[model samples]
Target: MMALQATLQHHPLLRATLRSGWRERWSFSGDMLPALRWREGETGGLLPQAEEIDLRREAGLKVYVVQDRSTVDVTFQFHHACCDGAGIDRFTDDLMVHYAGLREFGKSYKFVPTVDPNRLAVRGAYGLSFFRTLKRLPGQLVGLMGAAQFWGRQPIPLLAHQARDRCTKSTKAYPALTSFLLDPSQTLALRKAANHRNVTVHELLVCEFFCALWDWQKLYGQYSERHWTRMMIPINLRDASYRSLPALNYVSSIFLDRRGDQGGDRDQLLKGIRAEMEVIKRFQLRYTFLFVLNILNGMPWALKRSVQQDTCKTSVIFSSAGKTTRRCPLPRRDGFLHVADLVLRDIDGLAPLRPYNCVTMFTLEYANRLKLNLHYDAEFVSEKQSDVLMDLFVAGLNQVADTAGTQL
Candidate 1:
């Protein structure tokens, strides 16, 4: 672990995020301190929050190793201000390569990864226009107001109210988190199901998620004949044409609108999801705001706050890191050390202070296993409630798998 720390401490990506301080932009100044340590437990909360490296003063990443009776787990905590999941992927890949060289080759390894600054602008939809910016301003303003109302007033949405009687009250936001993991075999089944339906795994997950929400509402709350829900799906900009850059915030989120009034049919649901996703993938939603974000790497906090506030109208934010085809080079077992799990915690930003008004789901494939990590405001979703939703979600996926070729 000591050797691992030494290696990561020098990584260019980690160092860039660490040494840079945030204001309006990242400025290089203080040296960063990225740590590595061991704990005793199979399952435990990551490093204590009280005494530790300060993100503003130190590095935005920290690593914790836990030793259980039969397995070892590695936990990575990252400040959202510095990096996103894609950034984490790059770091993980680098870490694995470095570790493999140290353990297998017995050499002090080092390498730096470079990022293309003009990547976003090269996407063909990034040219700037004063008239376009001016036109979007009013819409952005409306979005901000809508967010404030959704988060503060907690009023029923115009479309939602027409469907059924629902309760809207502000509750203390607590951290209620959960995970739903599919073993390798189950993950394979899910892929096969998606292929059968002629849709991507992400579309399948979204369909099931919406179905699960509908099921939950029918079982626990108001049952609407026709309910309108909103979710934000972030698109990764580092694909194909644009090289994967080691930069944070290189993502743009597109909002998805779902209206489920028809009788719950898995085929219909999956079909709708696939259609919407296709539209989203095509034209790239005009690559909205990509050019703007690229220009402002570390957007001013006030601007971020304004944008985030405007997005409170969404019921959830669902992001899928897709699949990692490149295998992790870090040895799973190297005499005395048996890597059991690689856990990624999503406590980015000052989560408790201004918690997400809606639940957030982050899905990814690691070590060939599909997994989901859910983050919800505890006041809105208790532990029991979260369990119910997750159980339904898993069941929904399996149901699709069971009917793969026969159904949609």
Candidate 2:
């Protein structure tokens, strides 16, 4: 099932690279290796991972390329083992320089990889000194043992066929469409809006996403759902020692989920999310190490899956990007746009280890407002339902932007 679909998604380009003598680089990043399968009764199939990229190996460097035909009609996937947004951005910058030289003069540079999870100490190894200082080991509990505070889960469920929304570009634009993009001009406005709130771009983006969620839910009358959706935001881990390793998904997503389905008011939700980002960004390194500890626990299969899901549920997400460094150049300043390829899933293998009804929302980069790409399960949702969810995001963003302006 998932296996065959993975094959259809088989990037012939990647296969060619492998045949040309490529060696795969592995790391702590979530690698995309999924088994493709048709949900219960769907036509187009789904992958056993997130829907972000199609990374394949041919030599020392693993290539991550877009599966979509063009920028206008966007649909992409990712390998969870690769670096998250920021990490990949850095890798691409270096890669583009290398590629530019190669394409221009038939010469190429070899990728010198770095960092191996197999060798690193448990992330955030609170040295023995800290442990000895504690009156009692806190991780110990009722048969459960000590548990780190971070709930790190990456859930991969097989969603029912009815839940997915099939989206494709209609050459002639469709009505009720939600635009998504990373236009430089619009992004500047978003940053300015956040500044007015005394918040950073990332914080403002997080709040905007929640507002999108709230709006989508309200549009579909899902605002009263008993369960609150969990979001996962990946944080890149970089250090001098990591320079030797080939960059992979060297990131850990912090979870932002409601424990008891306690939703917040529009203003409150925005503030709460901003607060979480403020605190997490300040101590992101500690959070990454805490995640590394769980991976080392060596738990059984049941617990491993549970832990994985718990770790990821807090991070799955997609949104826009705007510059905080006001000095950043405009897209037109360089002719080509600094396009953002926002991804939310692993798109390589067809392993049953994928989560169900996974919803990845992407805002399309456009000249004006943006578009939203909701890559979700066809079984658990429909195209209309997906659009409704996006509507929520739209309403939320506009509402918050409006209020933030009023407050300022």
Considering only N, C-alpha and C atoms within 3 Å, which residue pairs clash in candidate 1?
none
Q: Give the Å error, residue 272, model 1.
A: 2.5
lDDT of each: 0.56, 0.40
For all predictions, the C-alpha RMSD in Å is 7.7, 10.8
- The reply for model 2, stretches above 4 Å from the true place, is 1-78, 107-179, 239-245, 259-264, 282-296, 305-332, 335-354, 362-372, 402-408
Candidate 2 residue-wise lDDT, 41-142, digit = tens: 322233223332334432122322223332221112334443343333333333333334344444343433222433334333323336442422332221
Tell me the tens digit of each residue's lDDT in model 1 across 228-313: 66666777756654444553545666665666564367788778777766654543442544434544446657456555452335
Candidate 2, residue 231: lDDT: 61
Q: Which ten residues in a row have the lowest lDDT in candidate 1?
A: 156-165
**Native-vs-model 2 lDDT?**
0.40
